[model samples]
Target: MRIEMTTLAEQPVAGVHICFFTDSLEPSGLGVHLLNLMRWLNPARYEMSLVCPDTPGGRWLMERAACVGAVVHPLTVRDRRDQASIDRLYHILTSERVTIFHSQVGISWEGMLGLRIAHRAGVPVRVVTEHLPYLLTHPGQVAEHRETTRLAHRIITVSEGARRTFLERGYPAAQFICIHNGVELPPERPLGEAARVRQELGVRPGAPLLLTVARMTWQKGHSTLLAAAHKVVARYPQACLAWVGDGPERPQLEAGARALGLAGHIRFLGQRDDVPALLGAADLFVLPSRFEGHPLAVLEALASGLPVVGTRVCGLEEAVADGETGLLVAPDRPDELAAAILELAGNSELRRRMGQAGREQVAARFTARAMARATMQLYESLLCEALGRTDGE
Candidate 1:
């Protein structure tokens, strides 16, 4: 379904009109989380709308949201001080009679302006979901984060670690809720699909295949992975690393791989749609991220029944049980990262056991349906409280 514009008079409000706001312009994990919520939230009870930048990246997300029956509003704000954009957003909220204004924050203060505008618009419920663990050291950002905590009726963190980070920062513990991010578990791949993916990537049969699906950014620790890959290739000459996703650091990462004589061993596949097939063909999954907020990549890997090897940081640590579903190493430690990869690559049985455990963990706790149900409960509770206040008044 394409995003079609209609007049406010033509489209009468039904159910709860929830407006989701984000400043992010790219199709990142935050976008994925929004899509999952929109796709799973019951259309009969919740009406979803999105407010994002009007750039190409934002349009990419808007199209998908429209496909899932979410109304799309494209607005671009240069920063928190963009008064014109803020005014436009306020108008949208008031005109749409938005019942809930929910903002998704990827970084500090990314969506705080929307929260403030929502409050000014007199929305019944104002919610903000912090998709990353708080590590704000800058004084200005810290102050803004505090303001966000004060403005939002409820703050959702993607992982417990993220909520704890806010708590440690002295935000009210009761205002925060940890809702671990979830994934749509794909059905088993058809026979021969994995082999087809392997052949396309030129990964020879019997060669150790390690897969990593993350944007090529410093936060994702692609350089550290390359360092570890240098060591990994020494042990297994034919080992292949299929790096998925693309970002600003891609050129530097490609140069680093070539400089380290790993050009042949690592394939920099930029943003592929066929990730499930790649995960199936690979023997091990790795994400040496410096930090995360319940990363979708690791969950997708686990759901695909591939063991993971990730850094021992907040979000990653929470998703992976060390020595169980996958191995965890200290961030930026190339030697330790390489050792973990070697350990998994050398033991086929261990990988199998860990992969099975990971799949079970995702099925039991990390499905998108579970996430949507919990979030819907929170929305309904807030709505009930709002109704009570209105009645009492």
Candidate 2:
């Protein structure tokens, strides 16, 4: 399965063929980032492909890749160490003569398997982006993660916090790079769009509409938000809490919301494609995660011109300005979270000012174009070094 290295001239006429490896094609922060990369990367310089499990859940991602003219190769990998799965991946990488293998590490074990297969198949460059800094909290993962870092040509992290965490776990600091996630600046929603979203959510005019777009999970601190929602409802009876994504924690979260007497005020919208429109219709945005890897949702929220109230954690700390764009309170502190939410919810003038500042912040530093350019530069440098090519040569 070893692939012969090609000289720069012998490379694909289209460009370097890079395969982005993932476990599923579900709509995730990483998936959205890849979709953005596919759209923004220069097609003349790079031929993009996505390698993922061919599950029913991944159909959405396959359709998205097809839309952008990127190739999609789906293989069923039931186990991380499945030899058949590795064989399939090996065949694809070798047959396509993949120049670079880039993987997003949702699960370290699966990512490590992909790297091993790519190495065996003679892929010249292998890269992995670690999205979760806290995955190393388990003592067992330290050795495996350290090995994965060693296997990669370069390890990319989405936040400084994540980089530091990995370095502390014995991964080489020189091998790590922090690349912040970015979001596309969406256009202003039509006036009717906002009104329609509010109407569909059963939110009346002038009511404080608090929006949070996150999976229903413990790490996301839905319970903390639920507790804060109770306090919010007691203060602003007309206020409503709308959740935008779904996960395994739905039933428990729903039960908790009901137990806290917030069933009437909280609405779980599951997953929706109209996040921008929903953000436009909302008064404020909140992210109660215990930790994060530079969430794009915060950037998207800022792009939609909404003030955010996020937990004081890694990615959120970087994205939110304490008193400028929004407020950041201690994680899992319901009272503090509620106080901040109430502060933003009670004052329309503060929300307007913070929202404007947030929009300006996103415009200045968090566009998809900036992220794409930085990533492309990294890719070119790595490729050049590997192929013994110099600038303009």
Q: Best lDDT goes to which candidate?
A: 1
Tens-digit lDDT string for candidate 1 (193-299):
88888888888888899999998888999899898887898888989999999999999998998899999999989888788889999999999999998999999
lDDT of 1 at 232: 91
Residue pairs in clash, model 1: none
* Least accurate 10 contiguous residues by lDDT in model 2: 1-10
lDDT of candidate model 1 versus the reference: 0.87
lDDT against the true structure, per candidate, is 0.87, 0.82
TM-score of candidate 2 relative to the true fold: 0.94
Q: List the residue pairs that clash in candidate 2.
A: none
RMSD list, candidates in order: 4.5, 2.4
Q: Write the per-residue lDDT of candidate 2 for residues 10-107, one digit (tens) a residue.
A: 45333788899887435477778778777888888888888877765566777798799789887654366567776788788877888888987754
Tell how far residue 247 is off in model 1, in angstroms.
1.1
